[model samples]
Target: MSQHIQRSIDSPLRTGLNREQLWEDHDKGLIKCWEVGRQRAARFPELANQCLAGELPVLGWKGGVSRSLKKLEKFGSLKYLAQWQGLRGEDLNIDLSEERELTCSRTAMVVTFTPDRSKYFNQVAEA
Candidate 1:
């Protein structure tokens, strides 16, 4: 039998299209799903630690299930800034925008963030 079918047969008490509903029901009591800010901080463990330790100001979450690094900037979180530094090559071309200068003391990354040229301008205007 398929793995999914075997799991369903083993747990006949699960009462949803899948086990996700059961998991969500159980997790709801552990975390405040309505508190978007706390959820945003949770995505970045460093920031989440600050939140649990009672830091000033806070990050906000919106637009989708995931938090946006740019939006979190208003709360003074710099996790993205550190990640950006990793993407720079030996020549140090780490500018995400024309006017921004970034420097990280760590080694460079092979992965880089490239704008979707066709939509970048439109998105920027909307922002």
Candidate 2:
């Protein structure tokens, strides 16, 4: 956990992205998700690294898009991280192993949804 926290401080996200602009571009579909993921990583490096390192599971819905997943996959645990780009309901989706729930407590974002809306995500978190 300390090392993960260190990585965030050591390698800060260099992109000069403004949150408002990022959201606008995201809404417009003009920005690639990977870049947004990078921004998230930069802004919240500790949480992002934690999720990537598998110290904790990070639940992502639309925010769990290819770009963010790709960015997060670099820290460690490729086995679980590799499934970030696949469609939902596929066997290749983010597998937490050992039937443990994939709950992302510290996320860059996208850990949204209620149990009623998505049982899959509810296991991740109640927020």
Candidate 3:
């Protein structure tokens, strides 16, 4: 476990469960993965269902879109996109090993949900 997450778990103010208890539960398979887009599921059930069904790719980023865009400028588009996919896969425990053609266009933005009911985004590449 990351020190940051462990610290949060250890802190009484943040959580009542300790690190050992959480890990024990995880080892026993009592804990499942995290869910995304709960509010959107309530507001737009069809769209959420589609994403869950794999008809759409649920988009996300490593940090704030503003920060991600800055990283893209530093790393270049292809490398940035790979890093985004890699980090998200690790966080979500998803397998991204199956090869597929990936593209990063000149005009790209990371559109994310769940920011006070308003989308948070940043232009990835300047036009």
Question: Which one wins on TM-score?
Answer: 2
**Can you write out model 3's per-residue Cα lDDT over 21-88, one digit (the tens) per residue?**
64355322112112223333456666445443333233343222332344332222222222232323
Against the reference, the lDDT scores of all candidates come to 0.25, 0.32, 0.29
Better of 1 and 2 by TM-score: 2
Order of models, best lDDT first: 2, 3, 1
RMSD of each: 18.7, 14.5, 12.6
lDDT of 1: 0.25
TM-score of 2: 0.26
lDDT at 3 for candidate 3? 12
**Candidate 2 C-alpha lDDT tens digits along 19-47:** 67654542221222333344455567664
Give the lDDT of residue 34 in candidate 2: 31
27: Cα error in model 3, Å: 19
Q: State residue 109's C-alpha deviation in candidate 1, in Å.
A: 39
What TM-score, over all chains together, does every model reach?
A: 0.19, 0.26, 0.23
Candidate 3, which segments miss by more than 4 Å at Cα? 1-36, 58-127
On the 0 to 100 scale, the lDDT of residue 19 in model 1 is: 43
**Runs with alpha carbons beyond 4 Å of true place in candidate 2:** 1-31, 55-125
Badly placed stretches (over 4 Å) of model 1 are: 1-33, 61-127
Count clashes in each candidate, considering only residues at least 3 apart in sequence or on different chains: 0, 1, 0
